[model samples]
Target: MQTEYDVIIVGGGLAGLTLAGLLGHQGLECVVIEAGEKIDRVDSVPDDPRALAITHASRNILASFHAWQCLPQDRLACFRGMQVWDENGSGAIAFDSTELGRPTLGYIVEQAVLQTSLEQAVRSLSGISVLHNSRPCDIQWQDDHVSVILDKGENISAHLLVAADGVQSACRAMAGINYRVHDYRQRAVVCVTRTALPHGEIARQRFLTDGPLAFLPMYPDHQCGIVWSTRPAHAEALLKMTEREFNQALQAAFEHTLGEVKESERRSCFPLRRAEAEYYCRERFALIGDAAHSVHPLAGQGANLGLLDAASLAQLILEAGVKGRDIGGRRVLRSYERWRKGENRIVMMTMEGFKYVFENQSSPVPMLRNRALNFANSFIPLKHTIMRYAMGLSGDLPVAAK
Candidate 1:
């Protein structure tokens, strides 16, 4: 017998789970099918090597769903300032949250902690159901609904099907949406390191000819999260180096900003790629998070973008349902696509432009880039606009927020 639901969400990651919670809160019946066997407790003390720089808009959305407060206070670290410098020059630009009258520019949150919080929120909603250890083997879209075949040979049907899977999205592929992909020929090496001095709630980034090296301030002061984007060969070498050698290399690259780096946790690497689907939705299917688009992590906007996608998509669905419209209709889903696609494309283009400008080795380019940075730093109005955009407050938003 096939189980039926109003919505069936594939991939129980952050985006899927958060959407499930939001829809359930609105009294919608939804079921989440997760391929993973289980969700476990996230290490509370920032032991995870990866963290996300969550924006204010994302926080607001999560708070509305009553999910943000579930995170442990100790696990969250607020950054009031950010400094960006040219790797070849002494020129730099800095942004302070006080300049914009905001208490924090953003928060650096552990990936596991964020995921666990969303999972807990999902579990508490009575209208949402979770199925683990299952993957969608097939999807069949009908005139009024869609059917999903699980790996266990069980069929499930729903009025709407949501795909929150990552960049290599099986759901998007199954939906037959046109997508464009670009391989950056770069890899991001992420790890945790104990600094000699406290970070003092400041996040830093250095733009080098190879790529960008970002230091995200984490809780407990002396520990920081490192996302070093470099060429694949260089990243591989760095990953295999001994602890002392790795620390030395890291310290040199960062110009000893945090003093001597002593130790590093597990190091991992992921290829940098950009993917944007032609549309975010079809008749009875929708795509959210990485499944829809993925930008470079230079600005640390990947996860935040995914969260925004979730919030906006949820709002659109709920409002349509409230109006007694066909929630899965192409017309309803088109609104989501039209709203989110353009915004995502702009960010992707901006990141690509930044990557190209900073990664060029021409001596003349550095001076020009540094001048631009200094100008941006000295200009109050321009800086404020940039800050607002970075805070996720200035982007094109869904009608729910309005």
Candidate 2:
């Protein structure tokens, strides 16, 4: 029997929804099976506090699917500058958008807002079907199609199955894809706070011996979202502190740069681990987003990378469809895997290196990092290259007409 759709996505988060919208825009018939009760919105924001540092490339991809404009402008904070410093009190490097001839390097957007926008875009698409509160209990691969059994005993099939189900992806596990995980022995503590001084459209990250502490600018003056990574033991102690104590520690860690700090939202912590699948594609399956690769949050490129993956995969399917080729063919899947795997591996390794170099307590390592930062700041070409990569402009981008 013929399947009802061309593809079945087993997650409704940003990656899944974004891909659904993109494919639907190209007139592809797809269905998204989300385990959650409903699509996440501002009110349904998860307790895990985090924000997205969206680059121009990601914004362009979203805009192509009409998802970018759907977001509230006021909720997005355009950061024109980014500063990285060594906590050893040696040196700091800053990148300004003006120097790169760009209005803004990127925007610091709340994860909830981004998810909400993608969800709405998916909801409005005629060719995309969304099944909420449905979990995949089992999966069977046949020669022509893959069958997914929901927890409710309903069976559905599709030509291809997309695993955007996040880092601990069930689809990836079911497909027997081995994962190599590197535990960083660090935990990321996220929260929101009010500052005495304005952030001035600038985001800052201070690399301490323990981990990296980043302040992402948000809407309204004197407001920013904080992601402070530290050893698991220290993170637990911090999480146990009272609101006043937590704010005091936070202010001190940031050198009181923003003056008095007040906690504006609940705090949350998540363990940091890096994971990459042995293979991004199998016979009739593919992995996207965290399911395929996850890296350190110090660079703030995790979500951006996932969005790029979705965009690239959608482009491959659309182009193949136009050329009268099977979208789920192993040849097409392999092409997508080849293009993204290397790029994702490089990012993971880069983040791992940064984590090691900056988090080392050895006095010599601090001096070395300080010297590297100073050199990077003084060299125009090197600075431009780093900025371009961070903006997602220079990389293995999808082969699609801009």
The digit string of per-residue lDDT tens for model 2 on 1-402 reads 234789999998888888898999888889999987674565566665687789888888888878888888877888999999988967789999999899999988888778887888888888888888988999999888899988988888888899999999999999999988989899999988898889999999988778999999999768899999999999999899899998999989999878878665788898899989999999889999999988889989888888888988998888888898888888789999998898888888888888888877777887888899999999999999999988888887874313
TM-scores, all candidates, are: 0.97, 0.97
Clashes of 1: 0
| Cα lDDT, model 2, residue 90 | 70
1-402 per-residue lDDT for model 1 (tens digits): 339988999988878887898888888889998887666565543344688899887888777778888888988898999999998876789999999998999999888788888787787888888888988999998999999999999999988999998788899999898778899999999998999999999999998779999999998999899999999999999999998999999999998999999998889898999889888988899999998888999998888778778878888888889889888888778888887887887788888888888898787888899889999999999999989888888888754332
The weakest ten consecutive residues by lDDT in model 1 span 39-48
lDDT (Cα atoms) of all candidates against the true structure: 0.87, 0.87
